[model samples]
Target: MPATETSAASTPGAQPSNHITEDEASLYDRQIRLWGLDAQNRMRNSTVLVLSLRSLAHETIKNLVLAGIGRLIIMDGEKVTEEDLGGGFLFREEEGAVGTERTAAALPQIKSLNPLVEVTALPTLEPFVGGDETAMITFLKREKVDVVVACDLSYAQMEAIDAAAHAAHTKFYGAGTYGFYGYVFADLGTHHSFTYTPPGKGAVKEVIRYRSMVQAFDRTNWALTHEKTSEGGSPFGGYRRVLKARQYAPEVAVPVLALWEFEKKHGTLPAGREGQAKELAEITSELQTALGVHPKLLSSSADVVSHFVVHATDYFPPTLAIVGGLLAQDVLRSISRNGWPIVNLLVVDSLRGTATSSPWGVAPDPTPP
Candidate 1:
C-alpha cells in the first residue's frame, strides 16, 4: 500500500501560533516556572517526528504531548498485537484494537493526552527503509520538522533517518531498549545553548559540534596516553597520565557494539536461539580488540552479552519508563535549550540502576575566549 498521512487535529496543516494561550499557560504553569516562559514558548512552537510507536515511543509521546509540544508526527508500519499490549499502554485490548495499525490504534490516546498539541500519524515507515534518504529528507523538509526521534529501530535504520535529519537541519535522537538495557544517541549539528552560572557571573553561551553516529561507532582511538602538565610537572612530581576515553563504560559499550554488529551481519538479534550467544560472544571479542578496549574491563561483561543476546527483543515496562523518561527529558532540553542535553550517547543499565553518557565522537564545547 502507498504511504498515507493522517492528523488527529481538525485542521491538518495548521501551525501552532507564536504565543501560548492563557489556558496553555495555566496547564503548563509549573513547567513554565521551572524553565521560564521563553523555553515554554520554544517548546510550544516546535514540531517533533517520532519514528515508531513501540513501548519507548509510547512513553516519550506521552511526555512530549503532555509537556505541550506544538505538533507530533508518529510513523510506524506495524500492526498492534496482543504482545504489544504488554508494554504499550497506548494500545488497548479492545475487539478491533489488536489488528489495527499501530499509529491508528495509538492516535486517539495520544491526542487525548493534550488537546492543544497537534498530532499526525504516518502509517508507514517505507520512506526510511532503503539506504537512500532522499524521500525522508523531502518529507522532513516539507513538514518543517524541528526534531526527529527514532525509537526501537535497527542501527542502520536510525543512521538513514539521521542522515535525512542532518540534511534537513533537524535535531536527531535515536533510542531503543534491549531487555534491561537501553541507549539514546543525539546528533544536534553545531548545537548552541546557554549554561547556568553563578548569580554574579551571568549565563554562559556554549556551542557543541557533534559528529554523526557512523563516525562515533567507527572510531578507532580508544587508547590512553600520558602527558606533562601545563606547569611542566604533575602534582606528584611525575608526568600525569591522561586517558582519552570515548565510551562511559567499556563493558556496556563493547556489548552494545557487538549487538549492532551481530544485527548487521545476521539481519536480526540473537533471540535466545542455540549458538547465538556464542556468535555474539565472538563478535564482542572482535569488537573489543578492534576498538582497543581493555580485556579486563570487558571480562565481567560476558553475562551482560549473554543476557542481551537472549532478551534483546523483550521489553520491560520499568526499563522502558526509565530509558524513555531520560530520552524525553533530553528531547525537551534539546527543544527548550534550557539545560545540558545528552552530548551524543546515553546508555542505561537497569540491572545496575545506572545511566551513563558517552561523548563518543562529539567534540568538546568551545573554550571561552
Candidate 2:
C-alpha cells in the first residue's frame, strides 16, 4: 500500500535541534562550508510537496533530495508507461514495471538518493483539482509542507495549487517544459526575506513583496509600448525595450501564454495535427500583437512560435535538466532563505541558451496606441 515515509527529523511536529550532529556535520562538511550551518539546518527542517512524476519532476526530486531537504512528499497518481522509462530514471524497463504506479516505481530511487532525507510517495491527488482546493489547502496545513511545486500541470491547476499554498502560508512554484522551451513561476506570498552578499559588501538582508501568479499575469501590460521612433514613426516600442531589459526574451514567453490559452479553449496542446501549427501561429501572433510586442520582434519570433505550436507537448531531456536544475536550486534557496529566488517568472529559450527573469504584475503600464 502507498504511504508516507518518515525519518527521525521527518516525523510530523518533531522538532530538530538547532545544533547539527557530528555525523551530519561530517557528512555535509563541504556544503556546510559553502552555505553555513544555519542554512543547512533550514533545509533539514523543510518539507516539500512536489506534484507529478515526469522527467522534470524526476530531475527536481533528485536535486532536492540530494540537497538534503528534511522530507519530500511526491503526489502523482499516474502509472508508469513505456514513455516514462525514457526520461524518468526512477522507472525501470523491466517486465511488469510499465503498469506500476509512478510514485511506487520512483520511491526507492528517491529514498536511495539521500537516506538522510525522508521520502514519501502519495499515490493520489484526490483533493486537488482546478475547481476546488479545500482538500489541498487542508493537506498543506496538515502536513506543514514548507513548499509546493506543481510540474507540467495546466495553468488553472497551478492557480489552484498556488491559491492553496497561499492560504497555508507556504511558498509555491509552478514549472513546465516543452521540447526546447520552459518556464518557472514563484509566489512566495506577500512578504518574504532572505540574506545575500553584494560584491565588496558584507552579508545583507533583503525583503520582497510578491504577487500571486494570477496577479502577476493580470498585471502584465500587454499594451504597454516603448518610446516612439524619433522620426515620428509608430509610438510603440515597448516590446524591444522589455526584451532589451530582460535576461530572457519574450519569444518563448508569448508563445507559452498562447499555448496556455489554446489549451484552455481546446482542451489539449496544439500538436501533431493538420493546420494546427498555422492556427497556433495565428494565436501566437494575435497574442504577441495584443501584448504589445514590436512588429519586427513578432516577425523574428515566428520560427520559435512555429516550433512551439508543433512540439508544445514534447519534452527534451537536456532542456528539462537546465530548467529543472534551476527550479530545484530556487526551491532550496526559498527554503534556506539563503539566496535570491527567481523574482516570480523565469522563461527559458533552450534554443538560444537564454533564460530571462521578469517581474510581472508589479505595476500596470498604459497600453500603447
Candidate 3:
C-alpha cells in the first residue's frame, strides 16, 4: 500500500473530500499551523475507535473532533446519567432523559466546535467485549478506521483489540489510570508482545496478577522488533526493563469497622438513593476482596503514577478534560509519525513528571501475510 494522504504515508486516498468551509478552515487555523497542510488533511481523513470508553472519554472525543479526526466510534456498556454530568464532557441536560439520546445530542456540539469532524457512539459492549467475535469483527474490518484506542479497558477487551489491530495492520494504542498513576502503549501496526516475553513474576512478585491465558504472551515484550514506528514501539528496553515493576498496596481486610470511607467522605448518597448506593458499594467491596489485584501487574519500576482527578470518582469535567487532552495528543503522534518507543505501554511518572513507554508484543518472524 502506497503511503498517501488517504493511505499511511505519501498515499492519499484516491477518493476526494468535500472542501472545508471557511468557518471550519478558520477554526482550525492554529492546528493547521502546527501539523501543516498535509498532516491536517490526514487528520481530517483519519478514523479512530475508542474502547472501554468511559465518561472520561467524552473530552478525548471532543478534542479529537477539534483536531479534525474524520470519524470516530465510541464503545462502552454504560449510559449517561445526571451523575455522569459531573465529568462527562458530552453530557447535556435534556428533558429528564439519560441515554444515547443525550450522547447523540452531544455530537453536534463537537461539529459546532469544529465542523471538519463526524462522530458516532456505540453504547453497547456486546459486540466489542464479552460477546461474539464475528459480531465485532466488522468494526476491525471497516476500511475507514485507521486506529483503535483501548481506554480504561477490561482485560478481555484489550486482548480483542490487540488481535484485531494486528490482523488488520492498523495502529493501536492503550491507556489506563489508577488512583495516581497511568500507562499508555502505542503499537505501530506490529504485534509487539509476540517478540520477547518480559521476565516472569517469581523473583519480583510471587502472587498471581491476572488469571488469564495471555499473561505469558504479554510478559514477552514486543517493543523489541519494531519496524520503524516513527513515534511508537521502542526497540530498546525502557527504564522499566532494568528494574522490577512496582507492586500495588496489599489488601488486608480489617473488618467493616470504619464506615468503609464512603459515608464519612461523601456524606452518604442522597436520601432515597442511600440504600441502593450502599448495596452497590457492598457488591464492589466483595468483588475487590474476592478477585484482588493480579500480583504480576505491580511493579516498582513502572513508568506510570497517579494523577487522580479530585472528583474522578464522581466524574468531574476538568479532570476528564485534562485526560482527554493528553489522550488526543498521543493519538495524533501515533498516527502521524512513527518510532521512539510507541508500544502498548506509556508510563507517565508523576513522581518526576516524566513519560516513557515499552512496546507491544510483536509476532514471531513469519512469512509476510
Number of clashes recorded per candidate? 0, 4, 63
Number of clashes in model 3?
A: 63
Task: Point out where model 1 deviates above 4 Å.
Answer: 1-16, 196-202, 220-247, 365-369
Best by lDDT: 1
**lDDT string, candidate 1, 98-167, tens digits:** 9999988998888788878878788887677653688888888888899999999999888878877887
lDDT of 1: 0.77
Candidates in order have lDDT scores of 0.77, 0.76, 0.46
Best by TM-score: 2
lDDT of 3 by residue, 82-167 (tens): 66665464656653336654345454554465444555655565556765556456667764678777776643456666666655
The best-first sequence of candidates by TM-score reads 2, 1, 3
Error of 3 at 277 (Å): 23
Quote model 1's TM-score.
Answer: 0.87
lDDT of 2 at 187: 85
Q: In model 2, state the lDDT of residue 201.
A: 75
TM-score for each of the candidates: 0.87, 0.88, 0.59
lDDT of 3: 0.46
